[model samples]
Target: MEVRKLHPLFAAELIGADVSDPQNRELIDTVEDAMREYAVLCIRGQGHINDQQQLAFARAFGPLELPPGNNAPGVKSRIAPGLYSASNLDANGEIVALESRSAKIAKGNELFHADSSFNDMPSKWSILRGVIIPPERGDTQFIDMRAVYEALPQAMKDRIADLKAEHSYAHSRRKAGADADDNLPMFKYMRAVQPMVKQSPSGRPTLFVGAHAERVIGMDEEEGTALIEELLAFAEQPQFIYSHKWQPGDIVIWDNRCTLHRGTEFDYLRYKRDMRRANVNESGEERCAIPAEALTQHYQQLSKAEAAN
Candidate 1:
């Protein structure tokens, strides 16, 4: 398999690999090394990949679908449980489950923060394949956090080096048009603490910023909001961003631990962009519920009042 860089830091397209039945141990190592070098890898000619084949291929890098607390149907938390599945619509004509027990416990792609960061046990990697691409508009846009960090002005870089942010699903889901059930604030208490910017495990400098980042650890609410927005503007440059026009049977993997990604909006009302998502858990990572102490006084009091009611 030949590895071709798709961007300065964000993506690389792998050609000449039969991803459907990837058995060559050497090829797997090469892909893993490439993934380490580049946060995202796009393998184009994945015509023969089934769910099991895809899962095995993804396992060469690290663990597969096995999230400690976050589990999904037809997927088990094993080294290679064939976690690779379609993230789009299901065969019976249903939306790729936005509301459910597993997903509620396991945060879906609602925020910009990395995947599985809330559950003390975060995931290692996420491999999503584009099984059925739309005719005209099923493009996934990826931003390079590594590039974002490299391009940061020295002043800003120094400011965020050791900073942390509050990540929550309730806050971000509400922003993304979910969170309708006010009584059941399942996401209100789901939050995570992660560094704002750090050197990736792969030796790449990446800014771990995302929509779920509620605020900087000590900054005022408004100031925190402004800071994240500013970073968003900086990282989302057309020069640093890559807009991949997905094709059917395109297998793509991303390192959620360090990168922040967003699925671009399309004409959901007119078009169907059915695909499946599969994530591999990273072990020994600790996750916790949002602390009551960290909450604003108003929301803190509300929790008390609700109990009395």
Candidate 2:
């Protein structure tokens, strides 16, 4: 496999390797090594991969998280349990209405975030495959947290080194002008407290703040928001970012532990952009085992209480 650097700081494109075959141990190891170095890796021309093949390849990293909203009643997903539908299409294979709840919720994705940061065990690797690429626009932009951390002023780094921030899916959605209580399985009132600076698997300290990060624990609310925004502004500088344009059959893998990503705008109402993603949890020891039935039940109760109000 040949590696081509996509950006000065952290992303690369790997050529001459097929990831569809999960049993290729050498290929998997090579990809993992590349991830430690690049933080983000794109393997183009993977349009031939089927759902089963994609899941198998994603599992090579670790156990997969059940896609959000998979437990919704009567919703049959084309992409299967382990893969999250990152597309604008509905379960019926139709483009969702712009005013629909799903579309509104998706607006939150436009803000940079580490996947599943609100969960107790945040995700590790997010492997996304482009099934239907739009003719133009809709690129995924990534920020290298490792680089961002390194560029921070010493005093700023010291200030955040021992601080913990609260992350919530609801908080980010609300920030995006979407309803926090939207009833999506993942949108429920859940929060995870994580250190602002954490060691990545690569042994580098990374800034963990993102859109999902609500506030720094023990600090005044407004003060925490200011700090988060300041760090985000610093990280948004062009030199630390890589924007990946999608191509049908392309599979892009990013480490959520050391990167933040956001989707760029596209003519979603006119074009079909079917992207599916499989997320691997941070570790096998702390794998999230939230039962589908339990999530379904919790949401049902929430809905009932809302209706009563």
Candidate 3:
């Protein structure tokens, strides 16, 4: 496999590897090593791989995260259980209307975030395959948090060295103008607290702040929010970013532990973008800061009460 740097700081294009070939242990090991060095790797030419194949490749890295059970009632997934439909297509293989709930929820993706940071056991790797690409203008931009941390002023770094922040999916959804309230299942009340600075698998300290990060712990609410936003703004600088334009058959693997990624806007109503993703959880025992089962039961009760009304 050949590796070409995509940006000065991080991200690379890895060529000549057939990720779909399960027997290729050497390729998998090389990819893992590449991920440790470059936070993002865009493996070229993987369009021929199916959903199962993609999942198999992702599983080579770590345990895959289960698909979220928060889909609208009666909307079944077109893909397999472990795959997430990161596309604008509905279950029936049609483009979703702009005003639909799915579209609204997707608006949150435009903001930079570390995948599944809201969960207690945050995601480690996200493998996304571009099955159907748009005609133009739907790139995925990534921020190298490791670079961001290195560029931070010493005093600024010291200020956040020991601070922790609360990351919430619901908060980001609401910020993006999506209807994320207590009516939703797991996201509404569940939150994860992570240190503002955490050690990445590469043994480098990376800033953990993102759109999902709501506030710094023990600080005044307004001040905490301001600080988080400031850090995010700093990370958004072009020096720390790498934007990847999608092409058919391209699979982009990113380490969520050391990077923040956001989807760019495209003409969603006019074009089809069938991107499938497999999220791999961080290596450890499965756990959640909030009780997932209790939250699901609460949502069910609310639905029942609303039905009776």
Candidate 4:
């Protein structure tokens, strides 16, 4: 397998390796190494991969994550329980109407985010395969947060160093006006605290704020959102971005710890685009959930304090 760097800041495209083969254990190690170094690895030309084969390759990174309840029931993905659909097509293989629930969910992808950041144990890596490609203008863009952090002024760095923020799927969903709560059992209302500046697995200090991040701890709502928006604006400089155009059978795997990504729109009404993704947790990291009891106590205390104030 030959690895070619796609950008100076982050992504690399690997040629000549087929990820679908289970016997190719050696490729997993190679890909992992590249992922750590490049942050984004696109393995081209695997368009014929079946759902089982895609799952097999994704699991090589770590255990898979189940789709969030927000995906809704009755909208079946080919690789369910582990794989999540990233497409606009419904279970019946027809393009969903623009105002439909599935389409609204897909619209949420327009915001820059790291997958599953609302979970205590956020996704370590994500693998996406393009099964059907639109003719033009549907690209997945990624940003290197490590590079973004490095480029920041020292004062800006110090300001965020000790800060923490809360991440919630509800916040992101609402951003795109996709909050049509269907009361699905799988819908986990998650809010987890993460360092505003986190140490990546590669040992670099990286910015962690994204679409799911609601507010910074200890800061008022307006102030916190302003700071988050400032950081987002600073990080989106073109030099740190890598936009990957889709091709059928293209497999793109990215390290979620140090990268932010968002899907670009196409002619959703006219074109059929099918993409499936699997999210994997870091090795040896067990699934973590914030205790409901603890959350309740914390909120009660906050309410009491506010009442006194």
Candidate 5:
């Protein structure tokens, strides 16, 4: 199988391999490397994969996360809702126009963000498949945090170099006029304080801002929040985005470790959507202060790997 780079910053298309091919180590590594370098991947031709097959494919990257309690049918503890479920029917499993608010919430995720940014232990990766997609309605979007980091002004970069942010899922959910806290498990009050601008452990630059970034460390609450909102806007420029229009046989794998993303809200009232997702973990990822200089090196390694086979 071969991988095609979609952008110099992030995103790729895996066109020459099958994911459910018995868990080959090299292929898994190749996929992981692609995700590390590109952050997001769209793979076509997979109409035959079922839940078990989907879950199996996702497990290749890591473990699955439990679904949040507010999820629809087929929701599990670690699985993210599929990209197409935005307009799917729950009753009799008919899957028509998306009816649930939870489903609509999925549609509004087009913004860049780390998965579960609201949680202290956010998920590390996500695998989503388009089980049913409208001819033109349900495209998934992605952005390159690493690229955003690279583009920051030196003064701004240095200003945020040692800063950290508070990420809270409940906070964002509440602002959406929804109750997210009741669904997520409660933990110690302490939240994730990851660097506002992180250099991935692999020595890649990664900006960690997202919709869920509630505040910054050591700053007044009001000021920190304003800062968070301002930066999140800057990171989500149209030039930084790649939107994926789906086909039934298409699958997507993304890295949450280095990028933040949101699902776009579409005309779920007019089209049916159903998707399945599986997730992997990086809850145990070691946080470090070292900045990566492998920006170009990482991209080269991934492209080379893609060419090798």
Candidate 6:
């Protein structure tokens, strides 16, 4: 396989490898290593892979993260088993209307974030496959957090070296004004005291702040928020971004531990976009930050209360 770097700091394109071929163990190993070296990697010319094939390829990295039960009611994934439906379509395959709550909350994708960072054991990698591509205006942009961390002023780096932040799915949803307090089910995710910078296995430092990071520990909420905003703005400078214009059959996977990504606006009502993703958790690292049974029981009681009301 041939690798070409897409940006100066990170991201690469892999050529001459059919990822769907499970027996291509050598290719898989090479691809995985390339992913570690370059945080974002894309494989083109895969327009025909089925959902099963996509899952198989993603599993080569690690165990897949299934659609969590903690998702809100309208948030049911359209795909089977483990794939996430990152689409503008309903379960019936119709385009979700712009005014719908699901569409509204999905708009939060405009903000840079790493998938599942609110989980204590955050995602290690995310493989997204483009199924239906819009003609224009839906590019996905990625940020190399390692480059961002490296460029930070020494004092700034020192200040955040040991700081921790809280990240919450509910907080982000509420900020999008998607009716998180009422229509949304009780969210069972809240990650507290996550270090502001994560150290990768190779000793590279990556900035971990994003929209889900609500506040920094040991600082006033307002002060923490301002700092988070400032960091986000600084990190998103044009030089640090690599925007991928989508093409049908394109599969882009990025290391969640060292990158931030966001989706750009498109003519949603007129155009339909279909994308599926499988997030791989860190190998041998699973956090029961909130016990599954406890979250289930709490939501069960919440459902009963809502029904009675």
Best by lDDT: 2
**Candidates 1 and 3, the one with greater TM-score:** 3
- Candidate 4 lDDT by residue in tens digits, 35-127: 988999999889788888988888777777655432332335545556778888877889999987568867878999998888777678989
What's the TM-score of each model vs. the native?
Answer: 0.77, 0.93, 0.92, 0.87, 0.78, 0.89
Task: Give me the runs in candidate 6 sitting further than 4 Å from their true place.
Answer: 69-78, 182-186, 283-309
Off by over 4 Å in 5: 70-87, 94-110, 177-191, 283-309
Task: Give the Å shift of residue 40 in candidate 1.
Answer: 1.2
Q: In order, what is each prediction's RMSD in angstroms? A: 6.7, 2.3, 2.6, 6.7, 12.6, 3.1
**Which portions of model 1 miss their true places by more than 4 Å?**
21-23, 65-91, 94-113, 180-189, 284-309
Query: Model 4 scores what on Cα lDDT?
Result: 0.82
Residue-level lDDT of model 6, residues 248-299, one tens digit each, is 9999999888899999999898889999998888746433335555566556
For all candidates in order, the CA lDDT equals 0.64, 0.87, 0.86, 0.82, 0.66, 0.82
Where's the lowest-lDDT run of ten residues in candidate 1?
Answer: 67-76
Residues 49-108, candidate 1: write the lDDT tens digits. 776776666655555544222332232332233343333444455444545432332233
| lDDT score, candidate 3 | 0.86
- The backbone clash count of each candidate, in order, is 15, 2, 1, 1, 23, 0
Worst 10 residues of 2 by lDDT: 285-294
**Residue-wise C-alpha lDDT for candidate 3, range 1-309, written one tens digit per residue:** 898889999899898989878669889888888899999999978878999999888877778776654333444778887788899998888999988767998999999999888877768899999999998999999999999999999999999999999999888898899877745556654578999999988999999999999989999999999999999999999889899999999999999999999999999989998999988886553333345575566558657866896
Provide the lDDT at 52 for model 5: 74
Instruction: Estimate the TM-score for candidate 5.
Output: 0.78
By descending TM-score, how would the candidates be arranged? 2, 3, 6, 4, 5, 1
Please list all clashing residue pairs in model 6, or write none if there are none: none
